[model samples]
Target: MTTYFTKDHEYLRVEGDTATVGITDYAQSQLGDVVFVELPAVGQSFKQGAEAAVVESVKAASDVYAPVSGEVVAVNDKLPDNPATINEDPEGAGWFMKIRLADKGELDKLMDEAAYKAMVG
Candidate 1:
């Protein structure tokens, strides 16, 4: 899988035509103690850079944007009841959703791991 990141701090782990989406560790840390997550429904579509989800924490509510265009194939149902899962594992079980990519070219606009790390730093 190839992982890509947006300047907004979202990550997209691409494997074949599908990608798993989530916030980065830095993003969750900044959000502080996640309390709720609003995820898009399966089959729901979003264009690149569009709001795909919402994450709420003690600090504030934040929008999670799509790194690339796609249709939601799955969402993590465990989040609403246990939002801290994002704090504990942002890139693993904490993933927000899985999407079947709508436009592969959109991936070119995202940052690779090294670029993202440097950009965030």
Candidate 2:
């Protein structure tokens, strides 16, 4: 699997045609204690850079953008009942959704781990 990131701080873990989506660890840290997450429904299509989800924290509400254009296949249902999981594991059990990629080329436009690390720094 390969992972890519958007400048908006969302990550996409691609494995085959589907990719798992989530906000980055840096984003969760910046948000300061997640209170809720409004996730996209399965089968919903979105363009790259479009808002795919909404996360609310004690500090403020933030949008999680799509790192690539695709149709959502599934979403984590654990979030609404336990939003704090995002703060504890933003990249793992906290993943927001999975999407069937529309354009593989869009992944190339995103940041690699090194580039993302530098940008976050």
Candidate 3:
């Protein structure tokens, strides 16, 4: 599995044709404690770079974008009740959604772990 990241601080773990997406650990730290999460509805379609979900924290509201174009197949409903889950595990249990890639080529636009690290640093 290869994990791709975006400049906006989103992370994507691709496994076969599906990808799990979420905000990065750095993002949660910068946002402070998350308070509410607006998840995309299942079946919703988004283009790469399109804003799909909204994460509201004690500090600010951040848009979670689509790192690759796809249809939202599932969401972490646990977030609505306990948004802090993101801060606790931004890359694991904190995953926001699963998307069925609209076009595999879209993944090319995202950054690799190394590039993402440099971007955050």
Candidate 4:
């Protein structure tokens, strides 16, 4: 799997044509104790950079944007009831959605781990 990151701090773990999407560890840290996540429905489509989910935390609510355009294939059902998982494992079990990519070329616009780290730094 190839992982790509957005400037907004979202991540896409791509495997073939599908990708798992989530907020980054840095983003969850910034949010400070996630309390809720409003996820996209399966089969729903989104454009690159569009609002795909909403994450609410003790600090504030933030939009989790679609790092690349795609149709939602799955969503993490565990998030609403166990939102703190976002803080504990933001990039693993804390993933928000899986999407069938609309265009793989869109990934070229994103950052790799190194570029992302430097940008965030």
Candidate 5:
């Protein structure tokens, strides 16, 4: 799987034509304790850079943008009841949704691990 990141701090773990979407650990840390997450419904389509989800924490409520155009295939149902999972494992189980990619080429616009690290640092 190849992982890509947006300047907004979203990450996409791509495998085949699908990608798992979530906030990076860096993002979660900045958000403080997560209080709520509003995810898009499955089958919902989003254009690249469009708001696909909402994440609210003790500090602020932030919009999670779609890194590339795609349709939501699934969402993490466990978040509403246990938002702390985002603080504990932001990139793993804390993932917000899965998307079926519309154009693989769109990923080329995002940052790789090295570039993202330097940017955030």
Candidate 6:
């Protein structure tokens, strides 16, 4: 799997033609304790960098942007019931959705881990 990141702090783990998407560790830390998650519907389409979901924390609400254009295939329903899962496992069980890549070329526009870290800093 290859992981791509966005300036907005979202991460995308691509495997084959599908990509699993979620917020990064830095994002969860900045948001403090997550309290709610408004996930995009399965089958919804979005452009690269589009705000596809919303995350609400005890401190504030933030947008979860799409790292690459794609159609949402699935969502993590567990988040709405217990949003803190994001903080517990930002890159694992907390993944928000899976999307079918609309254009593989868009992946080139995203950052690698090191670049994303620098962007976050």
- Candidate of highest lDDT: 5
lDDT of 5 by residue, 8-85 (tens): 999999999999999999999999999999999999999999999999998889999998999999999998789999
Candidate 4: count of backbone clashes, pairs at least 3 residues apart or interchain? 0
Cα shift from native, residue 86, model 5 (Å):
0.5
Question: Which pairs clash in the backbone of model 2?
Answer: none
- lDDT (Cα, tens digit) per residue for candidate 2, span 1-121: 9888888988889999999999899999999999989999889999988988999999899888887888999999989899999999999999999999999988888898999999999
Minimum summed lDDT over a 10-residue window in model 1 is located at 75-84
Quote the RMSD, in angstroms, for model 5.
0.6
| Stretches > 4 Å off in candidate 4 | none
Q: Which residue runs does candidate 2 get wrong by more than 4 Å? A: none
Question: How many angstroms is residue 6 displaced in model 2 relative to the true structure, after the best TM-score fit?
Answer: 0.9
Ranking by lDDT: 5, 4, 1, 3, 2, 6
Q: Model 6 clash pairs? A: none
Candidate 6 is scored at a TM of 0.95
Better of 1 and 3 by TM-score: 1
TM-score computed on alpha carbons, candidate 5: 0.98
Query: How well does each candidate superpose onto the true structure, as a TM-score?
Result: 0.97, 0.97, 0.97, 0.98, 0.98, 0.95
- Ten-residue region with minimum lDDT total, candidate 2: 59-68
Model 1 clash count equals 0
lDDT of 6 by residue, 6-59 (tens): 878889999999999999999889899999999999999999878899999998
- State the lDDT of candidate 1 residue by residue for 16-83, as single tens digits: 99999999999998999999999999999998889989999988999998888889999999887889
Superposition-based RMSD of candidate 6 using all C-alpha atoms, in angstroms: 1.0
Q: Candidate 3 lDDT, tens digit per residue, 34-82?
A: 9999999999999998999999998788888888999999999888898
Roughly what TM-score does model 4 have, to 2 decimal places? Answer: 0.98
Q: How well does candidate 2 match the true structure, expressed as C-alpha RMSD?
A: 0.7
